[model samples]
Target: MSHRESDRRQFLKKSAATAAAVSVPYFLTGQNAAAADEQKANESNDRPIVGCIGTGSRWHAVGPNAMQLGDVAAVCDVDANHAAGAKKKVTEIQSKKGSDRQVDVYEDYQKILDRKDIEIVTIVTTDHWHSKIAIEAMKAGKDVYCEKPLTLTIDEGKKICQVAKETGRVFQVGTQQRSEMGLRFLQAVALVRNGRIGEVQNIAVAIGGAPACNSIPVVDVPSGLNWEKWLGQAPLVDYRWAKNGNTVNTRCHYEFRWWYEYSGGKLTDWGAHHVDIAQWAIGQSEDGMGPRSIEPIYAKHPVDFKDGMPVQDDRYNTATQFHIKATFGDGVVMDIKDSHQDELGFDNGIMFMGTEGRFLVNRGKIVGAPVDALKENPLPENAIAEIYGGSMPARGNAHMANFFEAVKTRKLPISDVFTHHRALTTCHLSNIAIRLNRSLKWDPQTEQILGDDQANAMQSRDARKGYEVTV
Candidate 1:
């Protein structure tokens, strides 16, 4: 082992020893553990050592949330600045808790995965890197907490599900709307599932459009960044960036979301969150249930496209304006659109219209006829809990804590991979429909596109040599 690995192992050993004496290291030391029995108490008394992969702007939030539940022993990112910033944050968190633990920094995520001391890893990498890193982490015997839109393609989701089942790792996709948001989402789901919204005739999800960016200028790779490594699994391309006042637009970092090469634009960005809830509330998140057909009614991309592939590489290629219709096997029509409906009067939210009543829900509020009627007739006490697999509604950062608790019980978290893959499959199909500018027949049971070979081929991408995702 290298000197850094040697020190990490030694520090972990010492930290484990300290935890044994200072306090019982139950998987949950927070309010969630108040009702545990002695056997449960001893199940995972040693706090799990965690390693954070991809400490970018998103990691600033995810890393701190996870620190509330586990020890962050190490952080890794391709950019030296990100890794250094994450290490500093981890040290500050540990220090505030009265522990003077030193946080190790790494340029390669494989180093974090190779360390046996790390029991959990939070993957906040870009959309394309999520699958490869998560599969490797599970194979290395570590549970994973990965960010949203977990898979870049349909087949990648299948691969992740296969690995998750085979390894029996407790994985949590960071779709916090299921576990947080003041329990409004949970309540909305409960309302729909309990017939509060009647038969659910139609659902409309408005997840705003992607921004059109001017052609970003090709620039020299900045120091402390591994441009080649950062593009793992993605095609080798020139590093591009340009400055506009206080904002820097680039084909790297946060701007990667706007490029189809790295992400699916709003289809997967906000769609990952809103569409997941729409399907969840409609009770179509099961493995063999999903939209039967997706039609791209209207779509406008920033670049020209032929054969569903962007023609130019100098600009953002994802669809900027879209209105897609997803028809489920149950005759439920879900409209995923970019603009707000004047009737609904909200720019971003889910509106379920049903036989008897209707309601609207977003991060801000859950309102409408059915929600308003709750004043006179409230939902059952255990209604939302039942929808959430018996866990009471928890607010703020509970997603990470739920993952740690699952580490002890081996149960799936509120946002498990199975449901997430189903939701993401809908988003992926919608993107494909827009790219092809046509309608698609889907077989949710077989997870295939019916009679469309080219569309079926888009289900998976050939990774660049040396970066293919391995079992």
Candidate 2:
């Protein structure tokens, strides 16, 4: 171990000793503690030790939320600036709570994983890094709270699920829609599942498309940023300056979504939210259940493609315009489009059209003839609560709280990894179809692209050496 690692270990050991007398729960030592003893300690402890990874723009909010449930022991990021900022924020939150706690900052996440005391890890990393880090964390005996769009590809989802099952780790996917205030999404899903929408025929999901841009100019790697480490499992490529050219930052941080090399663009970004809710409402959120076929009716890309692979490496090549249709085995067609300006006449929300009535729901509001009818005769008080696995409605930070609760009780959270993966599979299939500009059959049961070898091969990508995510 390096001097820094040694110092951190000593600090953690000292902190653990101080916690026993200070009435604050510190790290849970994995050494020589029986399962029953660990459970008792977990139940009685005032707080858990949490490590926040990928402290970037999104983590500004996620980090604070995590501090609410546990003491943040460390913050890790590829960017030194992000790690420092997150460490400062963690300290501020701890201090405000009348605790004099110090947070360790590290550029390498492995250090955080190597610590035996970190019982929980929050992964808010970029799209490509989610699965690899999450899997390793679970193997390290740490429960995980991973953000939405859980995996970069369908294969990663399968691997994550397998590891989660084998390890019996509490894994929560950050699809807050499942536990939003007023339980609007839960209520909407209840209405559909309860047959409020009779014989659901179609659903429409409106989300933004990926932006198309010319080749970004290659530039020098900035100070305090590890470009190679940030790339992680992605193929090696030269760092480039931002399009604006004023800042030295590259197409990293929050801007990585526009690149197919790292992400599937809005197809996974926003679709992870909207598509997930769609699957829940339609009763296809579980494993072995998903769309039977995906058709990319129309698509526009920033660069040329051969066999679904972008030819140019410099440009933001993800599709900018797309109208993809996914048909479930039940003959329910889900139309995922860039906007609602098409014939459906909808905007950025989910619309469920059924024989009895139709309803539209988003973060803003839930409306339609079915929902309006509920005004006269509201749903039972327990209706929404029942749909959320017998738990009450979750308001601000309730999703995170749910993960903590599951960590203690060893129960599955509201948004488990299995269902999130099934939903994300639909999103990935849509992107694959759009990239190929063709319709393809899917077998959700086997999690395979049926009879299309090319499409099936796209389910997983070869990871770079040292970053491979093996089961």
Candidate 3:
């Protein structure tokens, strides 16, 4: 067999071995106990060996969810505390399943990638580190399940897609709204595609604004944290930490989202979800089909910006209040604003207005005339499943389950990177326009800002030496 085929066979053998070990207790407990509780711990021997990287707060959820579907053999984090906590968490979870699987912990993620037995990996690192690790993991012959806002820059998105196509690995972007959230987002898409809303006119995505902060105090880096590794791909900087009375902020961990150097702020944080849903529903999700021009109506930054770059590094520099209008080639306008009170009327959801009617949908509820009409007129029985790309499973943590199922079937998961790139491209452009304080004409086919050399240059940043992502 070829080297790749050998790797695949080895992965299967290890997975089968792990599965059999976990099944011994279930077998001894009798068939009645197994039948009464099918918590996936007793279900199948087709488990894929999983390795979780970046076990921070977010991975606490993503990792545990994946443990339910796969055999988690390892957990890695740059922070020692997080790595230990994740090991404890994984051990407790496996204990409940009556399986004494030893989950190895690591400070360096490369160790996890080097393991040939690991068939799948979840990349829940900060926004900037995602592309590099994911690319490396795919190169290591493993499937990837990564959190959304997957790319730190537009160019990174391009690189990721190239690697994904070359590897033909099953990659799932964790935008749960597409698969979960009561399938409200799916029903919204179905309603639009079925012409229930007629020809689409405009979509308002209401992802709230980023928080502004004063210059944070530079302090000693915390013990058990690798500041250099955590700031991968981004510029080197001092660890900043401050507690203003009750509110605590830092240039590390969860607070990294506020810095432009590390993340795209709220634009990508929340925009990744709302924009993906809007683009998917309106059929602008494919490549070469996106906004023709993006106009920044209003933008308020926490710190002054000079030529699209933040002047101050110590403070939160992302846009605090912004309204970006992206007009497509077909004249359909997508308004991405901070909140509904910005005059769009919905706080944290999408509002679709078409020639025939309009509707709004968020996580909590889907409302408006079009949605209300669904009760009496009703969507077709197969409408939701068809929109979802297949039959839907029961809705508890179905996104990770979808990833594991794709691992078995060798099919792409619902939230693949291809369309996510398209949606994130729009969001990245919005940030560019706001930062530059100018309208930009875009060529989606070329993936560049037309007639604007400086804006096009902002599409990618120079990665710090030794952290650069090279194929």
lDDT on C-alpha atoms for all candidate structures? 0.85, 0.82, 0.84
Q: Where does candidate 3 stray beyond 4 Å? A: 1-43, 342-344
Off by over 4 Å in 1: 1-45
Best candidate, lDDT: 1
Writing each residue's lDDT as its tens digit, candidate 2 over 1-471 gives: 764345334433543342232221222223332233334544776688999999988888777877767788999999998888888888887897676767898989999999987999999999999999999999999999999889999999999999999999999898888876457788888888667888788988998877665567888887999999999999999987665554333468777888888899889998999999998777676656789999998988888999999998887877788889998876789999888754535668899999898888888888888898887977887666656656563345667766776788777777889889999999999989988888999988899999899999999999999999888
TM-scores for all candidates: the values are: 0.91, 0.89, 0.91
Compute the lDDT for candidate 3: 0.84
* Number of colliding residue pairs in model 2: 1
Q: For residue 386, give model 2's deviation from the true position in Å.
A: 1.3
Q: Given candidate 3, what's the lDDT at residue 218?
A: 92
Q: On residues 1-471, what C-alpha lDDT tens digit does candidate 3 reach at each position?
A: 664345334434543442232221111123342222235445656667899999998998898888777778999999999999999999998898787988999988899999999999999999999999999999999999999889989999999999999998989999999878888999998898778988778888889988988778899999999999999889898999999999888988888898899889889999999999998776666656678899999999999999999999888988888999998765679999998743436788999999899989999989889988987999998676666654653456677766776777677677888889999999999999999999999998888889999999999999999899766
Q: What is the lDDT of residue 64 in candidate 2?
A: 80
RMSD of every prediction: 10.9, 12.1, 9.3
Kindly report which residue pairs in candidate 2 clash with one another: 340-346
